[model samples]
Target: MENFTEVLSKINTAKVIAPQIDYSDYVALDLSIDNEELAQSNLQNAKEYELYIQRFLDRNKAKIAFGGYLETRNLYQRSTVFKNLNSEERNIHIGLDLWINQTASIHAALDGTIHSFQNNTALGDYGPTIILAHHLEGFTFYSLYGHLSVDSITNKNVGDVIKQGQQIGNLGLPPINGDYAPHLHFQIILNIESNFGDYPGVCNAGKLDFYSNNCPNPNILLKIDNNT
Candidate 1:
């Protein structure tokens, strides 16, 4: 069995990013569904409106890159807009988002092998997604890159070695990247539990505790604060 403490301690050596578009950018806004009280309101349209703003941000990502660990939008359970969404889509965002325009180069966070890759096609899905497996300090973990362009997985194969900072893939565009906006839904998993090319990015309020513990913050790996 893998010890969680040792895995977390090794995080200090893991490659990290600022979680922003670039170094000089400041936080613009944050949106998250963690707010229990506000979630009760008929905020379905409000969430949609936020997507529109996110689309606008996608259009101008080159100029206004996202940074820091942000709670970037609100999602409600009553709204079918997000209700009908798959397990991977429901329960609002469960990871940090690195907002940027299309085709930004995605670098691997560590030396790992391609565990799996797929083009998850759906209105609001990961489009072209990739998962990398890493073994460190006697523990195994996976990293997921969603909203990637199709070209990213064109010649990729399982078990292929991906060095740290290698260009894993390019960001996908609207209609292909889950219909939300152009950004990277970067998440880390302690145990994939057999899911491939896709994992739960959102979880219900009833199950937040389990998901939160299983999916530790990517910021631990990104370590953005030290970079500045």
Candidate 2:
């Protein structure tokens, strides 16, 4: 069997969001430790961090603020879900984020069936998340859409067929979307394990190798130009 990464390399029709966004409109955002701007700002709050992202997009004249795969973020410190005495802090982001306006439509990256849907309402967690099960070229994988509006999972059911580019839901606002900015946390899961509607989008430093292998880079399917 081909590895998940190799299978993704052959895919040419993965659209994680609306197709109207052109390559020129995408701005690669840096929230990692390398970004000096974020290091100086107080990004503990979701709203405040959201404003920073907005300012960046506006300043760059771009519509989307993207990137953040395996980025070490300090913002997760605000939520106990990520940091606790029982375990090490989980700050490494394992997905690609698309920072756009609130209520923007989210589409299926590929043809798949709804595996699970739930409103994972916790501080700094995935709100109204959906997981899609897909099979291509004898490979089975899953796609996770997080930080979605409440209405997104209202009528959804398990095993529901979803076509590529089909409207899955819209991006949720703060508080509803785990108290963060309106953005879609899109991740590709090679193995979902026992997780239901929610999966770990962030991992601790120690588990980087395990999570990195389980969650392949979403850009392999989206094909978005990180250089842009």
Top model by TM-score, which number?
2
lDDT of each: 0.66, 0.89
Clashing pairs in 1: 16-222, 20-66, 20-67, 21-66, 31-71, 31-72, 31-73, 32-73, 124-178, 125-178
Can you give the TM-score per candidate against the true fold? 0.75, 0.96
**Candidate 2 stretches greater than 4 Å from native:** none
In Å, residue 221's CA in model 2 sits off its true spot by 0.7
For residues 75-148, write the lDDT of model 2, one tens digit per residue: 78888899989999999999999998645888999999999999998899998999999999888899999999
The alpha-carbon RMSD values of the candidates against the true structure, listed in the order shown, are: 5.2, 1.4
On the 0 to 100 scale, the lDDT of residue 165 in model 2 is 90
lDDT of 1 by residue, 68-92 (tens): 2334344434444446645433554
Q: Which 10 consecutive positions of candidate 2 have the poorest summed lDDT?
A: 10-19
Which stretches of model 1 miss by more than 4 angstroms?
A: 1-22, 26-28, 33-82, 85-89
Q: Provide the lowest-lDDT 10-residue window in model 1.
A: 63-72
